[model samples]
Target: MSNRLKTGLILLTIAFLLGCILVQMFTQTLKSEITTLPDGYHNVLIRVPTTFEFCGEQVPLYDEEVKESFDKELYINVFRHSSTSLIIKRSEKFFPIIEQILREEEVPEDMKYIAVIESGLENVRSFAGADGYWQFMEETAKEFDLEISKEVDERFHIEKSTRAACKYLKRSYKKFGNWTLVAASYNRGMGGMNAALRNQNAISYYDVALNNETARYIYRALAFKEIMQHPEKYGFVIPKELRYPPVKYRKIPLDTTINDISALAVKYGMSYKTLKYHNPWLLMNKLTFDKKDLKNKKEYILLVPQNPPMPHSNVLAQESLQMQKMLDSILHEEDTVIDIQDVK
Candidate 1:
């Protein structure tokens, strides 16, 4: 190549490299500025209560480390506005049922916050294979006498799962003799919690060092309890009318297998989508009973809606109007009819 051409190509390559470096430098500076907090808002204020209790056991807020841990969790939860607000709204719908069950099982009502923390009061599955509102693993769920079959998983059944959780909590209380430890044990398995206690020679949960997830678990539950109990104090003010109301439904008991759930839903004047919402435990479109279930005469309870939600779409509204028209036409035709014997 000619010297002039070679020189021009070399200069172009150098300019390109310099331009790339400059762009990267500018991007890094922009990121650093974007992440910096605005002036005078450097630190957040989260007020930790002077005294706190979990299941009526006093939180050792006097201990500096425990106080700091509690403060951290409170800070995290207080700032989680959207999640915290939705939880507060859902609490209205679920708490009544949970509280009654807890009372019947003689478990502490405060323990309900564990469910809030575990699944945000929703039936959700974890990456670790824990499922349902209570976050019970398949093995533990079965051990607690919860049914986990292909056709049905009772862990998603709110009433039954809450009962199962209470049973586990009572058993844990028996083991630890302390609700706080039981809460800790719920995160770290009972075996893991025992091992941690033995290895650290620690009597209380606050004294023992734990894995990050387990360490934060109890504090998260406590934070939720504190925030939910006094939501307005934390800047959450969900209106009374905005809260989710408890679902209204009637239970139908059946021993026979349902070969076509869609047809059954149609028979009840509901959509398959509506049926699934009330009976989330019914995992598939159709539910079947084994020969053993038939022989034992096992009865499965299905929740059919007494008051289904109002139609939100134009199509659904039209369908509802048509159904009402059909009903009215039948009643009108009956009123106009005369018996053959009366005519004669």
Candidate 2:
């Protein structure tokens, strides 16, 4: 081969190797950039049944706009896995009680989901200073006969607060003449909703354009209802045991002052913490009652844990007593004596 041709070939080989190295480096840089990019939000598609009735109103879940809104909520809630999971778990403990009250009040059972949207089924204080599972403000709670005080806040009391919510919804329904408006009024006060209705001259909640929070309120409620009703559809598979069970207790009437809750707890064979666990409405270590006043009789209701014999309590108690007697007999036997000091 000619020297010039060999030299050209050698130069070509060097260029090819350099080009290959450059390409490899560029590919890695591109891969890293792709990996580092923030994850894109994926829109989840939820298949809701055609139409669901809430409080005698037909909500078209399958309608295009309704489905889109529902899908948006499903995606948002599903991606917010932690919050949704906790809500689901807490619902197990709270829903039964709320359901019973709603049934008694003749309110729609679906209205129970309203609590989930309001506070995620938690007794949380809002940035606006609203408190409790129902998120009742001081005035509203008082208006509903919920005791809101430093010493006693019944907003934290699930049963009382739920009953208060029922009253509010019923009144809202009477005023608005529709369930959707009633639900929306929960977010925007009855006055606010009425004002909106007058300003917009619209009877329907959907027609009224509202501020951001109030606008999203009804949609969030319906979304919560959708996801919670079929949690499996949202990739939430909580074990039955992971769900909290409703605690059982007997309501004992105690007109007298409870000076020592710890001693009271011990008398019931439970820890003081346990007593408070079941009755969180008890604000202080000691309950004060006006002994002289007749009205004080209704002031106190002590919830004592029903120590109903466990399924195995009888067997275990009997075995423990037998074992104690055997040990006592052995220790107190006069025939059993030992030398004090053998070495001496």
Candidate 3:
């Protein structure tokens, strides 16, 4: 072989060996750094408070069984960091809306926490066919006077569903005569709770021996109330700005049927997705009323952006420009150097 060719081959082999060594060093360094945590940064046991209350009714923490139940729930929620963190973040957005409705309905202000435990302040449908933030079943939702049709389910409507929940709570309060029983009955159903009380001869919820879910129901709510109220004590240190912000919107009240919801969104200078985000109760592409609904002149409210959205095309164009700028910056940057000695 020529001297020139031999020299090139040796140089290439040396470069490959050096690259492998550098990669090995980098991997080991990364592993060491990640495995070592700073002092005092570790999971710790949550301390149970001596006293607790729900909606002004005191929890019987003095009872050993009840105290253990409370401790179990607190440990579960405190250690379930991801779920609890999101719940705290979302509470900032939704709690104000719920608190107002509860106050206006004369329900205890602490009743607002029920929604947090119910749906995590989300518009989610449960596996047992319960729907929305309040997790109302179809029949119960209708009984509470929330409209449930093909194109719209008012249970998914935040403001309307909250009012409906208030109605149920008020009625339950009249039946049970206390906010604590009313909260319990929300989980165990009014009729079921009544039967349980009659059979057990128990007046207080604490005195009843019920099914597992119904048993843990009040304690779970209480646990969430404590952690959410004093999150920092449980080691949740989310910043105020990191919490979800409340959305602002203007309501468009209409009794007329809409043939094409997408067209309506375009007319309002927004996309159909944006419209649906604001009004999740709109379940279909088009909305129509039957003769009965038309005769009754049923009204529906559609939430539109407070500051109208830019046209969909404009938004796409802006996003495209931003993406292109990012790519350009990455492509045009100077080469990054990783010194082998710096790896450790």
Sequence-dependent TM-score of model 1: 0.78
* lDDT against true structure, model 3: 0.89
Q: Choose the strongest candidate by TM-score.
A: 3
For all candidates, the clash counts are 0, 0, 0
Report lDDT (CA) for all predictions.
0.89, 0.81, 0.89
Instruction: Summarize candidate 3's per-residue lDDT along 1-344 as a digit string, tens digits.
Output: 99999999999999999999999999999999988878645455587789988999898888999999999999999889899999999988889888998889999988877788889889998989999999999999999999898888999998999999999999999999988889999999999999999999989999999999989988999999999998888888889999998888787887777899999998888889888988999999898877887899977878887776677687789999999999889877767555689898
True-vs-predicted CA distance for residue 106, candidate 2, Å: 0.4
Candidate 2 global TM-score? 0.75
| lDDT for model 2 | 0.81
User: Candidate 1's residue-wise lDDT over 137-213, tens digit each?
Assistant: 99999999899988899999999999999988899889889999998898888999989999999889989999998
Error (Å) of candidate 3 at residue 243 is 1.0
Clashing pairs in 1: none
Q: Would you list the rank order by TM-score, best first? A: 3, 1, 2
Candidate 1 positional error at 36, Å: 20
